[model samples]
Target: MPGTERSLTMRFLAEPKDVNFGGKVHGGAAMKWIDLAAYGCAAAWSGKYCITAYVGGMRFVQPVLVGNMVEVEAKVIYTGRTSMHLGIEVRAGDPTSSEKHLTTHCVAIMVAVDDKGKPVPVPEWVPVTENDIFMRDSAIRLMRMREKITEEMSAHLS
Candidate 1:
């Protein structure tokens, strides 16, 4: 069921297939999980098809090993007319244990789309709780930083 309309969480086992030669989960696999979780949250909130517009501010905090329980959570921290800014977190823990630690975190921006792939409006997200307020503010801050980085990258092409 729907615990939260603006958030989605997925849990799975980190399998050997997901591991790299270093015996840790591959970075690409982790990124794919993040994108999937963010997409789920965006689609649930918008009730429409969504496409990933951007993913950034990624931090790999720790190694996620095979046999670990992996949890990927995505929350809609902010919403624009057609875009949703998601705060995604990946956690890992031994299934035998109750504690989980953060392994990865990032921000993903998803745009809702119509059947023809045109952008469509997303439901507005309003911060109510303290954590919600903080996350929304953080999303805005990340957006500002992203704008600066884009501008700098574009200047090199001129």
Candidate 2:
């Protein structure tokens, strides 16, 4: 199945500079890639500049190694008045081969903004396929969970 315009895929080679002292691609580098991919998807879907409002459920399942071919895919799964929820996955494998394994997964919330940097409405997303529906539902669940966590933390910090 082909992705709609609301999705973006980025592919690149993991470089030595991305590696940590342990020789694996650093988590920060992977996070940067995730943010970039999510921003691209949100901007394309909304047809406006977007800023990351939140990133949740980020999990590093495996380490990416230098020389690996990295692929990051971001898909718009849900939407609010001004926010687009994106499901992002990062995968990596040998540069010479086609096989890839999941390295990271997360949901990012991006808010479209106007020239003045104020939040603006984004185009709504509708899930048409089973997979899309599943992703959207998952994103919603993650959002609810994040809200609960935030409330809990606020009680402690406030």
Candidate 3:
């Protein structure tokens, strides 16, 4: 996604420590990758430190095995007055076969804050490509879903 407010790519080699008893990478480890990738995107977009405010629609489609190289790609999908949403894709690279497989995907919402931890407005974002448009649209859909879920939960509680 070109002209995105920010983007980041990180790679890690899967190891035994990252795996669970089943020899597959633990869900928590994958989540950690997501968090770091998203945080980096937000910080790059804001040009300052950003804090994660929420996470949504984290789905693990497949398990990554040890000895595979994993790559996480993150990009800013949208920005609000004080927040931004990052879309992340986790891909697994097979060392022996040299094949890459998308294993998981997620969206992370982050808030821009001042030194005192007060929310701050985000700067203008630029979207110059089709990939950027797709990412933005996905973020919009996720935001609407979040709103709908919140409303439903509120109604249920009431």
**Model 2 lDDT tens row, 12-100:** 99999998999899999999999999999998888888999999789999999999999999989999999999999999999889999
| Per-residue lDDT value at 84 in model 1 | 94
Ten-residue stretch with the least lDDT total in model 2: 1-10
**Residue 18, candidate 2: C-alpha displacement in angstroms:** 0.8
CA lDDT scores, all candidates in order:
0.91, 0.91, 0.84
Clashes of each: 0, 0, 0
Q: After superposition, how far is residue 24 of candidate 1 from its true place, in Å?
A: 0.7
Backbone clash pairs for candidate 3 read none
- Cα lDDT tens digits, model 1, 63-95, are 999999999999889998999999999999999
Kindly report which residue stretches of model 1 are placed more than 4 angstroms away from their true locations once superposed. Answer: 1-4, 156-158
lDDT value, residue 65 of candidate 1: 91
Q: Which structure is stronger by TM-score: 1 or 3?
A: 1
- Each model's Cα RMSD: 2.0, 2.6, 2.9
